[model samples]
Each structure stands twice: as C-alpha cells, then as structure tokens.
Target: METLTNLESFVRSAESGSFSAAARRLALTPAAVSRNVAMLERNLGVRLFQRSTRKLTLTEAGESFLAAVGGNLESLQNAIAAVSADDGQPAGVLKISVAPSFGIGYLLPLLPEFLQRYPRVRPEWHFENRTVDLIAEGYDAAIGGGFELASGVVARTLAPLHVIAFASPAYLARHTLPADPSGLIDLDCIVMRSLSSGRIRTWNMRNAQGDEVIATMRETVVVNDPTAVREAARLGLGVAMLAVPDVLPELESGELVRVLPRWWADAGALSLYYPSRQLMPGKTRSFIDFVVEAFQREDYARRFAGSLG
Candidate 1:
C-alpha cells in the first residue's frame, strides 16, 4: 500500500513540472521528493515520471493518478489548515521573510520580546536582499516592499518605508550637488539590484503633471547587499539610494546629507503578506497580529528610532 502523503508529493512534482520547484513548494528536499515519488511508483507497480538528462515528464500512470487524486489532496490540505486555525494559542514554527536592512535596523530588537511573549512560537526568519515566492517556498508570511502583488495573496500594511537619496558629505562636497534631480545622472552611482523582479533598480521620478519616469544612472558599482551600498556611499565612493529611515542617523551626525529636500519616494510599507487560503495556520495569524501590534505600541516605535517603518 502507498501512503497518500507520498502520492501528494508525486502530485506536487507534476503540478510544478520540476522536482526542485516542487521541493521548494513542499518545504522538502528535492531528494526527499524524488524518494517519495519513487516509493509511490514501486508500490503502485507502475512508472510515474519519464526522466531524461534535461527534463522529466509524467508517464501515463502519473497523469491518470493526478486526475483522480489532485482534488482530494487539496481538500486534505484544506482540512488540516482548518484544524490548525482553531488553536487557542499558536504553537510550532513560523517561517517568515523580510528585507535585509529592515530586519537588522528594525525587526531584530523586537524579536527578543516577541519570542519571550510566546514561548511556544518558534520563528524562522529569513533576512535577505531577495524576495521568495511565498507559496512556492512555503513561507507562512513575509514583509515585502511595493504595492502590487498576486491577487491570491493578502497584504496588511505595517508601516511606511520612505525612500530618499543621500550621499556622504565628502562625496557631495567634491561632486557638487546635482543642479536638479535630473543632474544626478551625470555623476557616478551605486546600483542596487532588485532581488524580487531581477530588474535594474531605478529611481522613479515624477514631473509636475504627475507622470513618473525611471531615472537610470550609469552604475559605477553594483551591489546586492543593502549595508554594502550604504557603506559605499558613506566612504564617498558614490551617491547611493536607500530608504530614508535607514540613513537618518548619518544625516543627524552630518555624515550623510540628503540630496533633495522636496523629492521623495515611498516604499509603501514593510507589510505582512500571506496567501489567501481559507484557513490560515494559527501561527500565521498570530505573527501578523504580533507585528501589527508591535508597530502600534508607542514604546516599540520609539525603540526602533527612525527605522520604525
């Protein structure tokens, strides 16, 4: 007899069309997924996927099995989620993703308190300069930038992350501040690579008519790490752009100077985003509340200083 859960693995592989992608979806290792599928095939006395060096395709049995079992597997998952949602107090692990600078500059301090508040809640926080495909990666929730997202995902705004341009005082003294916003183009700049979209990050500038234009700079340096980009700016290497709250300390200390006072870009928020499943795991709900409540508390906001957003 074959386990239904093993069959579920086979189904996931078929849906994603790649074992590695399915592994990410299931939060399992690719080898484990392959083993489950192999075990299922042996038990059923039929081959499932036709494998080759570059690709794998479902065999006749796999296609029929999916047609029979896919809906049932989805229902089973929904039932589990329904049961998990009723817990009075959330327990177990919550896997969350967030931007690197936001984690270090803001969230890290609150973590001590959050963990203490709910001893049973274990959080696995992934702090990177990249965005994870939440459903594919099996993340419970993520704090992300920008506004638009897939319709099936839910987003709750935590706070605003105002963006601004700043350069080290020394760099400004040498280059002479751009005559206007457009003049920054002529000078050297450090480009921040967008992890989620893979598009070259550009400053979105708006004219008086409210039309936005992307300002592309000649990149003198390309860096993925947020801290490294700020460091580059700090050392007078070039003008670097970052969230406003991130460089406030440097601004106050006269280490970095805000380039233009009037123009600013909004990062919208560091939001709590999750899938639109009918029943969210209790841990997922708990974390969203915790983050939202934490941001609302006056003391908590003060603690982060300017990085509250």
Candidate 2:
C-alpha cells in the first residue's frame, strides 16, 4: 500500500513540474518531497519522473499513474482535512489572494474581528492586481472582479462592478463638468490601460432608463493601475473612470466627485472565488461565510452600485 504523503508528493510534483514548487505547496522541504517521491517509486517498482537539472518531466509510467490518481487526490485530502478538524473548529492557514487597493481599503479592516473569531486560523494574504489560478496557486479563496472561472472553481458575487467617471473638485473647478460622455472630447482625460492587455480601456456607459453611450475621451494620461488612476484624478490631472468600490472612499470624503454621475458601465460583479469541491477546508468555509455576511450586513451591494448615483 502507498502512503498518502508519497502519493501527494508524486501528484504535486507532477502537477507543478518541479520539486521546489511542490515542496512550497505542500509546506515541505524539497529534499523531503524528493524522498517521498523516491519512496513511492521504490514501492511501485517504476520510475515516475525523468530527472533533469532544469525541469522535472513525468515518465510514461508517471503519466499513466497521474491519470489514474489525479482526480481522487483532492477528495481524499478534503476528507482527511474534515476528519482532522474533529473539534469542528476552523483551524489552519487561510491563504487568500486579493487586489491591493480593495484588500487594503476594505478587507483589511475586517481582519481584526475575523482573527478574534478564528484564533487558530492564521491568514496568509497575497495582494496583487492579477487574477490568480486558485487551485493551481493553492489559494483557499480570492476576492476580485473579472476573473475567468476556471475548472473546479466557483464565484459568489458580492457587489456590482460599475465604472463611472470621477475627478477631484479642484480639477472640476478649472474645467467644465461634462453633461455627458460626448462632452469629454475636449477635456483632458486620465485613462486606464489594461495591465493584462497593454491597451487603453474604454467603456460604453448606460443610464437607469437603459440609454447607452460610448465613453470616448482624449487619453491625456495612461496609467496601468487603478490606484494610479485615482491618484492622478486626485492630483487634478484629468477625469478618470474607475469602479465605484475603487473610489468609494474618495467619493465619500469629497476628495473626488463623480463626473457624468448619471452614467456608468457594468464591468462585472465583484466576487469571492474558491474551488468547487465537495468538502471544503474548515478555515476556507468560515472565511467565505464571514465575508459574505459582512458584505450583506454593510449593504455593500447597494452602496457599490453606480446606478444609484
């Protein structure tokens, strides 16, 4: 019989393509993972991987074995995790990925209360702007909008992602406030360049009555980040279009005011993403419930809606 650790090491090594990566995911040393795989090979009487200085490649035997066991590993792990949590307390490392601005501004505030409730769960948070593969990257959950739903992943929407035009009061003081998108042609416009695509982003804005208009503007400043766009607008550079959640604080504080307030573009829904598994880790389940409850209690869905503007 093969040990679960040996099977897990072989599977993770096969999936990640390197012992070091597998070690990181498994929270083991590279030597330990290598030894586990070696042990598994010794037990099975066949080499699973072709070793190399640059990359780890699976052998024909390894490929077949992976195909046989890959699908069942997750279920076995989840079952073990559920059983290990005998006290029904959510305890362990809760790994999460989130966008920097949104995570720092909103989610960070909830940490104190969350930690108080789940004292045994340690949070490992990665704040980055790109969409992460939740299962591949070993994240328990992720928070953001516009992520593609990959296999074995699911999304729970928290709020509407509405892009609306905004500028500092100082900037609007010097220029005419656009009555609509067309009036933005003569104004200096701060635009967002897509970080993934390397192209300037433009949206088609709509009103409550379903009136649509293209938000075509002169791109005076092109920034690749939401924070930069907000800051540029705050520095009175030009008008910027941003998601309501991104600039909610600025809007509430009068640091930035909405321009063409009646119009906004529906980008998508801000979502909580996680793996779609039959049995979830207790910590992941608890964190998801906490965030969803917080969002509901605070009425963020309505507050983050630009249509209400």
Candidate 3:
C-alpha cells in the first residue's frame, strides 16, 4: 500500500499543478514532494504528470488515478486531521504574509500575547508589499487589501481600506490645501507605483453624500512602498495619498495632517485570506480567530476608515 504521505504529495501536486505549490500546502520542500510523487509513480508503474519548465500536466493514467482517489483521499485526510487536532494542542509553524508597515505597526504588537497563549505554535512571517498566492506560496494566512481571491480561498474582512491625501504641516505651509479632489492636481504629490501592475496607482475619491472624483495629482515623487511614501511626505517632499492606518501615528503626533478631510477613496477592505475552513489546521484556525477577535476588540474597522478624516 502507498504511504499516506506519498499519496497526499501526489494528489496535492496534481491539484496545484506543481510540486512547489504542493510542497507549500504540505509543509514540505519541493524536492520532497517530487520524490514522493516519483516513489508513487514507481510503485504504480505509470507516469502521472508530464514534467515541463513552466507547467505540469496530468497524464492519462494520472488523471484516472486522481479521479479514483481524490475524494476518498480528502475525506480520509480530514478525518485524520480532525482526530489529531482533537487529541493535541495547536502546535506547528504558522506561516503568514502581510505588508511590512501594517504588520509591524499593528499585528506585531499582538505577537507577545498570542505567543504567551499558544506557546507551542511558532510564527514565520513574511513582510512584503505585493499580493501572494496563498496556496502556491504556502501561506497559512495573508492580511492586506486588493488580493484576487483564487480557488480554494476565503477572506474575512478586518477593516475598510480607505485612502486619503495627507501632508506634513511644513508642506502645507508652502502650498495651499486642496479644497476638493480637483485642486490636488496643483500640489506636489507623492505617488505610489503598484508593485503588481508596475504603474502609478490612482483612486476615485468619494464623500459621504456620494460625490465622486478621480484623484489625478501631479506626481512630484514616485515610490513603490507605503512606508517610503509616508516618510517622503513627512520630509515635506509632497502630499501623499495613504491609507488611514498608514498615517494614524503621524496624524496623532501632529506630524501629518489630512488634505481633503471630507474626500477619501474606498480602495476595498483589508482582509485575512486563507484556504477553506474545513481544511484548515489547528494553528491556522487559532491564529485566524485570534486576529479577527483582536481586530473587533480594538475597533480597527472604524479607526482605519478615511471617512473619519
């Protein structure tokens, strides 16, 4: 009989269409997933996947094998995982991805209490600006706005993603504050280059009464990251459009002030993305619940809203 590990590797590789992706889902290396698949193929005496540089395709026999075992395999694995979880504490390497500014500013502070409560769980965090493939990259969870919800994933919203124009008091002293979104074009504006699209990011600003305008500002400085943009604004380089969470500290400190207080952009919601609930491990579930509860208790949803500007 084929070992459950080998069968799982084969199935996940087939589903994800790559050993690397399967490795992430299985918490193993790509080589380990490949080796397991190879062993399974050797045992079955048939090739399961057509290997390639860019993509993996299932062979005829591989497709047949997958159809035969996929459903049963998942049911068995779920049963095994459920039993194991019931018997043990939530303990494992919990891998997550988030934006550096938000992770450090907000989520990092929550780490100590979380660790104290769940000492057996280890956190491996990746702080980056771009959206990651949760299944392909093997993240336990990701927190951010504007992620394309791929197959087998679900998102729980934590807060509104509200983009508002801001600038230092020094910069405001040199230039008149914009009366509306239209006047923003006259000011020196620091803009962000979208990491995924490699283009200047723009947003449509709206007021509570439903007045809408596209914020087309003259880019005096361009940056790819949110933190850098905030710093540039702090240095009196130019007015910058940033999320409320990104500028809350500066705003509170009287370093940064809102430009168009009534006008802001609705970018989307900052969300926590993960694989489906049924397939989630104990650690990931615990982390998700903890984060969601924390966000609620802190009322981050209201605090992060640009409409409050």
RMSD of each: 4.4, 2.4, 2.5
Tens digits of per-residue lDDT for model 1, 1-309: 567669778988898888898887776788999999999988888998998767779998889988999888877777776776665666767888887777777777788888787767788888976667787677888886763577678888665666667788788888777644577788788878866666767767543445554555678988876788888889888887777656766776889877764555555665778987767777788778888887787343343222222
- lDDT per residue for candidate 2 within 102-201, as digits (tens), equals 9999999999999999898999998999998887777889999988999999999999999999999998999877778888877999998888989898
Candidate 3: tens digits of C-alpha lDDT, residues 141-243: 9999888999888999999999999999998999877778989899999999988789998889999989999999898899999999999999999899989
Candidate 2 displacement at residue 209 in angstroms = 1.7
Relative to the true structure, candidate 2 reaches a TM of 0.91
Model 1, global lDDT: 0.74
Q: What does candidate 3 score in Cα RMSD to the true structure? A: 2.5
TM-score of each: 0.76, 0.91, 0.89
lDDT of 1 at 107: 74
Models sorted by lDDT, best on top = 2, 3, 1
Ranking by TM-score: 2, 3, 1
Candidate number with greatest TM-score:
2
Better of 1 and 2 by TM-score: 2
